[model samples]
Target: MMTRVVVIGAGPAGLVAAIRLAEGGARVALLNKGTGGLQLGQGTLDILGYGPDRVERPLDALAGFAEAHPGHPYGVLPADLVARSANYLRDLVGPALLVGDAASNLQLPTAVGAVRPTALASPSMTAGACVDGARFVIVGLRQLKDFYPELVVGNLVRTDLPGGGRLQARAAMLDLPAREGEIDSTGLTYARALDDPAYRKRFAQAVKAVVEPGETVGLPAVLGLDDHNAWSEVAEAIGAPVFEIPLPPPSVPGMRLNRALTARAKAAGVRVVPGSKVTGFRASGGAVDSVQLATAGGDRDFVADAFVLATGGFESGALTADSYHNVHESVFDLPLRRPEGHLVHGDYWGDPQPLFTIGVEVDEQMLVRHPGGDPVYTNLYAAGGILAGATRWQEKSGEGIAVASAVRAADSILAAAATATDQGAAS
Candidate 1:
């Protein structure tokens, strides 16, 4: 009999979980709200801290992990799988999706009108250049998003480049609006403009004009350089090396990757049901029995021997805690670990504390822990950004963490199921 697994959310964490589960021979169904964080589109993967010094290129770190964990879901069965996935993604969008060690040495054009060496996604890139002093200009889209040029500048200043030289930064706005021509002050609205070639051209030109002749411009990560040709063309025309930076969490690129993963999962025979909300779950003796889903078609019950929760942080709207400090597992009322505080720290970059304390706490096997520190459901597993301890932002290990957790969770799930079947047969 095939094991049926239902996964919540379609974000990177969710999609990756679904993919691994399905590949493990389970009938997997991925559910999402259709628009949970996909539009940000800053296409850089941050797998920070690997290799001898706990410092290596992002791609190299991922590649090394894939090589070491060949049987892992994120790991490629063959050595070329890593390159193949990278190449396929590069082909889909544009050539800017750089792979290999060379990326560290690659000179990138910046909005500031200067060029700089690209930084690995893991270790945070310090703002100032070691060589000639450079001016940094941050390009803001007039009506786009939550991106605050001043705030980014402040962060860069705070981080202080490796050298003592001061990194100067200024902000300029691009007058782009959302779908209906209405300007959204949040600035997140300009993300949609990337799909338009004309918009890209105009934005690139505007950025070029603002950059001081000798200075480097640090544009928001959404410059629409989705391909290599476009990246090069924009680089040549702008006459500045462009360094793509990772946007904040719930980022557009993170969302887009999730959507892509969902489509791929569906094509691979995984059932994807978006807009289906799970309201409650039925569990007995610490094991999930079934889940109640609220959909447009009405209430539907899904029974599965195993369940995977990918519903992300407080934003994804999956796990909610009550005033009494009781965390309710959205689907099954599964016991969850509640943090003492809503946030580990008030400041975004204040402390590099683990994010897991705020999320559902799980054991090493990726199984959610109950309030009493007991495994709630042996068959129920959680993975991705939802897992505790992973600070996607400060750690720069978002994608790698998500992929690695998914692989680990899938392995555990399969192993548990096999053990169950063996016990049943003996009985």
Candidate 2:
């Protein structure tokens, strides 16, 4: 008998699981509400501790773990698989990896002047570069605009990068003015700028003019570069090495990855459904049998041998728990572990000490746990950012954790199915 697995959501976590499960000889179907939340990100996998100190290059650290744990769900595969995945990602976006030593000093150009200091690899390197009196030159486009330079300056001030002194930053707006009463979209806007090589070159020249000689310029992640090729030219022409800063609220990288993965998953024979919300689950004894999905056509039942929940946190609209101390799984009514307070602290900014607290409890095998600390579902598994007890943001281990957890979950599910098949054959 063929084993069918239903996966919800198309974020990094969900996509990774779907691919791995398919490779494991399981029939996988992925469902989501369009795109998901990945596009909003900057697309850089933040591996915080890869250096000798284990305090930076976090992705490197995770890579080491993957290397050690051969056949583990999150472990690194053969060189070919790694190369293929990296190439696929690079083709989809600008670059797969942003390499830089943590201890090396970076020269940052701000509004006032240039500042040189030891820079750490982060999605947003501008803030950290502001230390040692780095001058920041913020470039803003006229029409395709989203980031605010003033806000970044404020954050730099809060961090006290410049010897606890004030930051020197300047803003240059690249006016891509729009027509009156016209709606501007991300694709169209990007197309308008990227279609013309001369336009992009002129824009780069304008940006270069604003910066002093030998000063590194900080720009938004959206540089209007070619989807397939542009990073090298853009970096060289701009003179100063450009650092792409991540935008808050809605991340562009996260969104792009979601779309790319969704398309790839569908093309690979996986049924990709969106806007179909999972209302509840049908369970008997200790196992889930089916899921109730609500779509425009009305409610329908999707039965599968196994299930993978990747709805994500509150942002992705997966697990919804109210202030009354009551939590709803949203789809299967799966039991969740909730903290008393919504957030550990009042302020939502910065690392906030312990950071956010919203995840499910899973055992070593990646099986969701019950209130009594026992596996709730034999064939059910959970992974990615939704897994409890790990903070992806503060820990700077989002991509690593998601990939690792998904691998583990898929392996466990496959192992369980194999065991069940063997038992039935014996019986």
Candidate 3:
């Protein structure tokens, strides 16, 4: 019989775990509360960004990360797998995702114009990476509320590209299309408009007017939602390389990635149950017997041979705190890595906050463990932000930790199931 595996949380880690488990012949169910963290993310996969200072060589930094952050998720797993998983994700997402290699980092400009480093980025996000002697003309939609061309240009002007190149940035805006009032004029609305060839052509012309030859044109990430060819058409029309700078919240690129992964997961035979909030689980004898979630009808329980908890930390509500300041793991109420500060903190720019680093402690096999280093459940594993160590946002290793741990946990589950089958056969 195929192993029945349940992966909780629909973020990159959960999705990846479910997909891999299903592909490996396990019956997998992926559950999510809301859309997960994709929409709120910056859209690019940042394996590791800064290590005390900006990191030019990500793979090299990863080698030392285990030493500096001995309790980090990357530390528990082999360094080579962590490195390989980055490449694995780029391949898994397909070439269209346009990820860079682990050997180096991609330096892209943020919405505010400050240069940031990431290991993997979308094609549109990496378009203007040629910072050395690079000049930019940024375009914005007049009606879009969040994106500001002036802010992006101002921040970019102060930034010199990664490769010792001088930077020049200019700002421009396009008047809303005459029919723009018909829609809400949001980033999603703007992307749909650009999906139409006629509208895209006109918008391209507006951006082209501000850009000179050989200079890349940067625009908000609203090029197109489902239309992969939209960015190319605009670039072809403008006669220059066109790139997208991400917006603050509800990021378009991030949504696109989630959609892509979701589609692929569905195709791979993974059962995706969205909007299903897992409220609790039943455990016995150091193993999770079943998971319970609230349904429209009422609460439902699911039994599985193995479980992977990719439930995110504070942001996704997988981990919570009360007024008393005690942080609790929402699902199994598993022991946390650190008890006192379920959500403690330091100054934003000062030392790393103790709260973010506190999470479920896992063994090398990725199995969630008791505080005393005993496995809470031999068949229950945890990954992503819920797993302990490393300030992900500050270190910029969010995607790296999520994908690597998920993949590793899935592998361990499959191996354990196979061993069980062998033992049963001998009996």
By lDDT, the best candidate is: 3
Candidate 2 Cα misplacement greater than 4 A, ranges: 47-54, 57-136, 150-171, 178-192, 195-198, 237-240, 340-358, 418-427
User: How well does each candidate superpose onto the true structure, as a TM-score?
Assistant: 0.67, 0.72, 0.95
State model 2's lDDT.
0.57
Supply candidate 2's per-residue lDDT for 105.
Answer: 34
lDDT tens digits, residue span 21-81, model 1: 7877889877776654434323444354333223334455555654653222233222233
- RMSD of candidates 1 onward, in order: 7.3, 6.8, 1.8
Off-target runs (Cα >4 Å) in candidate 1 are 37-135, 141-159, 163-191, 211-215, 225-232, 244-250, 283-286, 338-359, 369-374, 385-400, 416-427
Per-model CA lDDT versus the true structure: 0.56, 0.57, 0.83
- Higher-ranked by lDDT: 1 or 3: 3
Model 3 misplaced regions, further than 4 Å: 182-184, 339-346
TM-score of 2: 0.72
Q: lDDT per residue, candidate 3, 1-427, as tens digits? A: 6899999999888888888898899999898878878778877777788887788887777768778877878777665787787777777777666567766888888888888888788887778784767788888877886888899889787765667866887888877652546533678878888888998888888888888767788998988888867988899989998899888879888888888889888998998888878988888877889999899999998899999999899998888877877788988888888734335555677888787787999988899888657898889999888988878888888988898898899999999989999999999
Per-residue lDDT value at 327 in model 2 = 52
Query: What ranking emerges by lDDT with the best candidate at the front?
Result: 3, 2, 1
The Cα error of candidate 1 at residue 102, in Å, is: 14
* Cα TM-score of candidate 3: 0.95
Q: Where's the lowest-lDDT run of ten residues in candidate 3? A: 176-185
